[model samples]
Target: MIALLRGFLWLTGFWLAGESLVVLLDLPISAGVVGMLLLTIALLLRIGRLEDIAAASQPLIGLLAMLIMPGVVGVFFVADEFAGQWLAVAVALVGGTLASVLTTLLLMRRCMPAAPRTETPQETSS
Candidate 1:
């Protein structure tokens, strides 16, 4: 229970920071998203350890599916409305997936150093 409380505190603190950034910077992004980005940056920079977060959040992680039920149900209720925009939906899904893949590739390329090159002797004759 204490772990849960600490995790919630950490999550809430990051969320508040995200909200502050959104309000002060006038960003179009959501507070939650901004907060997550901030958290990622901090983790990458080794400013915080994952164990500190996992200790608190691990308890709630199992309930993630239950937490999303309302959103899933809302979408189900609007299924008919969405049917009319199947083409648009398809486009958005495909486009978003493509963009995500490309973005990941770019980030990996930028963050990871290139492998050392090796030349085969078969090409030396030319």
Candidate 2:
């Protein structure tokens, strides 16, 4: 319980920092996203442990779909604004997904160590 409280504190602290940055810069991005990026950088730098975040995020992850449902539903309220641009939206979605997948694949390949190659029996016998 104490750990969960600490985790929430850390998360909220980062989120507030992100929101402050957005307000200062007048950027047009979600503060939560910026906060998450900051948190990821902190974790990668060993400034924070995954266990701390996991304590809070594990349950949230379980409810992710439900959490996103409001945003999905909200889109319907603005559906008329997109009445004639569905093809553009579809193309953007597909392009973005493919770009994300390709970027992830390339990054993983570059970051991960290659597996050891095994010689076949025939090559070994020769």
Against the true structure, whose TM-score is highest?
Answer: 2
CA lDDT, every model vs. true structure: 0.83, 0.87
Estimated TM-score for each candidate? 0.58, 0.59
lDDT of 2 at 87: 88
lDDT of 2 at 120: 50
- Per-residue lDDT tens digits for candidate 2, residues 19-68, read 99999999899999999999999998987667877898888789999998
For model 1 the local lDDT of residue 58 reads: 71
Stretch of 10 with least lDDT, candidate 1: 114-123
What local lDDT score does residue 117 receive in model 2, on the 0 to 100 scale?
67
Scored by Cα lDDT, where does model 1 land?
0.83
Regions more than 4 Å wrong, model 2: 74-126
